[model samples]
Target: MKEILLVLDLDETLLYATTNRLIQKEDFVAGIYYVYVRPDLEYFLSQLAENFKLAIWSSADDVYVEQLVNKIKPSAVNFEFIWGRSRTTKKRMSLTDEYHYVKRLSKVKRKGFLLERTLIIDDTAEKSMLNYGNAIQITEFTGDPHDDELLLLASYLEKLRNVENVRLIDKRYWREQVKSI
Candidate 1:
């Protein structure tokens, strides 16, 4: 199997949660209301796991991430690792000067995955701006049962599985194709 590194975002990317409210801490459960897992999420993830190294990088808290990923699979065999807000870095907003956390892809690179073979699937473009070309920005998911972003992404990733470098693939086309859907 190829070793493409795929970093995924949880909220609005893999699943849609109604709120970010903290609900529990004993067993690490949170966001139990109106949470909708993406259509084809399991199949998409299973396929991706076969073709690439899978890791989740969500802005949500660690407990929430654990709760969500556990629901996907109690053993969580589908993911190589899961990262929460603690793994992100705070950056000062240029416009408002307010500090906000951002997932620094560079942080993942330190874990031995080459940047060229890695891609971050996130809804927020700003979150991936640090590694512009390595991002596959998707539309924010809002509990749409008909959403096929992951299915389309599966096809796209399949084509790139054998490519020497994912960066060589035209990202504009990816953006256009995803947005058009």
Candidate 2:
């Protein structure tokens, strides 16, 4: 089987940034924002890098994304790509006057990755709405030191490593699926 490309979101999925300092010390600071990394992030990235081609795509300022990626990414693991808001397609909601930056998997497809074997992990549903079949909705990381979402996610991703078609699996209840396994 072809190697699966795992595209991860930056802000809420892997870390949280805020101007208001939390009780705990932040892992780092990005500009004016105090950033806290999700627990077990280094472990998660190192482990996944062994099984999947990893990349990052965020709907945030390009410079900000690059800065965070540089700080958190392990020295040995290399990302296939690190993208930001400029790469996303801006779309307006049908029912509300809200706009969301959508990551279209077709862009990845254009870069030679098969959509059937690709996966994107993100906290917000709206961001990956255009490619729901390839999306794994992770719980938002809000600077909790005890958060173990990445640990659980690593286990879940292990199960998907050899899947013939990752899109065929229903990942809507990924947490429940991971627990049941």
Candidate 3:
């Protein structure tokens, strides 16, 4: 089977950053923001890296993304790419008149990765709305130290690692699927 490329979102998916500090201790500081890492993040990344080629794509500022990634990334793991806001498509919501950055999988295809073998994990639906087939929407991680989403996601993704076409899977019920496992 072909290798799958697992693209991850930084903010609110793997970690939460804000100017105001949370009651829980901050994992690290990136520029003006205090960052809180999701529980079991290191183990999650390490586990996934063994089965999937990993990358990071975030809608956050380029400098901030780099800083955060540098601080959190494990020394032994390598990412295929680390992209920031400059790589995202900015669009205004018709109903809210609010602008949000969207991560288009077409950009990953440009890099020669097959869309069928790619998956993007993110918290916000709007960010991956254009490519829901390849998206696995996770709950937003906002400095919840007790959150075990990553642990569950690691197990779920392991089940998907060998699939020929990741996009064909119905990931909307991924949490339920994990529970069954």
Candidate 4:
């Protein structure tokens, strides 16, 4: 089946990390992401994970991100991976952008995703090059599941995961294949 590797953002994208609208949480003591995931979170992610390979990218410290991800998703429902970073270690570019994330995803080829079927879901369209076809800009949630936008994004991700088969990149450009076809 076709697969997707997700580089989900921590704040505004998946769930708010803090109430003050700050990505950097200082007063929380442990310096962890602080926010309550919405009720639709589980059902939405459960469906998405069924068809996609998940990876968390918070820009939050790896150590802290792990704890927070575990708490937010204890059942491992939608998270196949738990990553933490905005900029790739080598290129030093922001991964929130589809171009950067696509490049960033390439670095981990040997380690994960034999197929470069990856996508980034974030609230901010900070990076524009990949904005048109490769992304879904979600409105940040504030513990309200009634919000329609969050519902739509979740539904969209779930639907995106199924494409019959996943192709391996192996010395080839996956995006090129998608574009050429």
Best by TM-score: 2
Q: Counting only residues 3 or more apart in sequence or on different chains, how many pairs clash (N, Cα, C under 3 Å) in candidate 2?
A: 0
lDDT of 2 by residue, 1-181 (tens): 8889999999989999999999999999889999999999999999999989999999999999999999999998999999999999999998998999999999999999999999999999999999989999999999999999999999999999999999899999989988997
Q: What is the C-alpha lDDT of each candidate?
A: 0.78, 0.95, 0.93, 0.54
Q: State in Å the error of residue 115, model 4.
A: 6.1
- lDDT (C-alpha) at residue 57 in model 4: 66
Residues 1-181, candidate 3: write the lDDT tens digits: 6789999999999999999999989998877899999999999999888889999999999988888999999997899999999999999999999998999999999999999999999999999999989999999999988999999999999998889888789999999998985
What's the distance in Å from true for residue 18, model 3? 1.1
Q: Estimate each model's TM-score.
A: 0.84, 0.98, 0.97, 0.62
In model 4, which runs have C-alpha deviations exceeding 4 angstroms? 19-34, 76-78, 86-103, 108-110, 114-116, 127-133, 143-145, 164-181
How many clashing pairs per prediction, in order?
A: 0, 0, 0, 1
Query: For model 1, where is the 10-residue window of minimal lDDT?
Result: 21-30
What lDDT tens digits, residue by residue, belong to model 1 across residues 94-155? 89887766888788878878888888989987777787778888789877777988898888
91-176 per-residue lDDT for model 4 (tens digits): 32555433332224444455665443666666655532232344445667665645555456555555456643223212123333
Pairs clashing in candidate 3?
none
Q: What's model 4's overall lDDT? A: 0.54
TM-score attained by model 3 = 0.97
Q: Distance (Å) between predicted and true CA of 12, model 3?
A: 0.6
Misplaced by over 4 Å in model 2 are: none
The candidates, ranked best first by TM-score, are: 2, 3, 1, 4
